[model samples]
Target: MAEQALANLHTDSGMHGRKAERFAVNRASRILSINPALSGISIRSCHLLDISRVGATISLVTTIGLSDHYYLNIMGTANRIGCAEIYRNGSRVGVKFIKEIDDELLHTIVRGDFFTAAI
Candidate 1:
């Protein structure tokens, strides 16, 4: 629906005609928090089905509507600022990634590391 450039050009023969690969990790997720700057602030704990650089697909026990707007502080990453529009499929909610997960937390999450993290 939109004209996108995709990614930057590396300008090398091996790298020239290629694009970047994205990583997606899927799991059950609970709503940690939201950004103070955004409106339409309705979210809750749900089963996060899939995750990628673009966004996340989730199942909300309740309905939260969709829009390409809002700031989400996913997993308590301060540098992580982005918007997620709620897309419903049966009981699932789809959210697109608008920010990058911070390095330390992202590392821990990718490693499947869990501790009694005090919120």
Candidate 2:
């Protein structure tokens, strides 16, 4: 399912072109905390489809009521990124980080090191 979403995004005519290369991390299921600092409402689960330093693609059960801005918590690590919605298609959403994440953290996530941090 995650792979299909990534492929759809690539084929989607609306893509403006990506700023950074994305790394496939479909094996991880991370948590999406909606405006955590403000509301503390967290979605049960969302899969990390692909990621880059600037943004990521997540798979959700439903996009309903999702705000334009939210916080994504990378499950196995103490990392939370502020994200702004770029686009949503069915259950997939493309988001851009409010601030770029460092390469070390990006590599850590791509390497699947956070798997041990998952609860």
Candidate 3:
């Protein structure tokens, strides 16, 4: 369980050049470290900057050369948000989901909660 809410990414404004609106989520999450697909890399800690149904913004110390694919594991449940890198800005990154989240999950995050179930 290593996913934070999206309101903590220090972004009040929406992501640049994105069609969807991104909501800020200030919560804690962990990057999966032991994936065989991502060898030679350890788990990195990051914060959820913002999120939408299609994508999310994350803040990390360094996002250089990170795999284009990620499994954004949720903190409290057996859920993971699969995504692919879309853009990068120093320590921040924009990602597009492999599968979009549903309206229910959106409500949970906006209400100050994590995505507890797989969407």
Candidate 4:
């Protein structure tokens, strides 16, 4: 039987350095990457390793080798979750989900061009 294909994401502090300083959670809100639809010009599924309202770390495996770039559909919302490059071995590829619990900036990134998944 062929191996099933799916993906996941994970995240935490220190994933990104100065670029990812903690934002104040004054009026806290939860950010989730749902709507991983298999549509759109560039989109793929990933294993969500970890995530905060902001962003997440994720893992994906492809029988074919990975390209330096790709987009992530966070499995629920129409929003296309962003991703940055990460290590890869054989069919396994890793990336950081780009978004946060914060609303404005998060919307900005997703609303604009897709960026590398920062960690």
User: lDDT for each of the candidates?
Assistant: 0.45, 0.71, 0.66, 0.41
lDDT: worst 10-residue window of model 1:
1-10
TM-score of each: 0.46, 0.70, 0.67, 0.39
Cα lDDT of model 3 overall?
A: 0.66
lDDT of 2 by residue, 1-119 (tens): 33432332322322466446567676455555556466667664788877877788899888887888877887666887888899999999988888988999887776663343243
Q: Which stretches of candidate 4 lie above 4 Å from their native place?
A: 1-43, 53-55, 89-92, 97-119
State, as a TM-score between 0 and 1, how close model 2 is to the true structure: 0.70
**For candidate 1, what is the lDDT?**
0.45
Give Cα distance to truth, residue 31, candidate 4, Å: 18
Candidate 3 lDDT over 27-104, as tens digits, reads 566666445754555577787767877877788888865878877754543567888888898898888878878877
Root-mean-square deviation of every model: 10.4, 5.9, 7.4, 13.2
Clashing pairs in 3: 2-30, 4-28, 6-24, 6-25, 7-24, 7-25, 7-26, 8-25, 8-26, 9-49
State how far residue 31 of model 3 sits from its true place (Å). 2.3
Query: Candidate 2: what lDDT?
Result: 0.71
lDDT of 1 at 14: 26
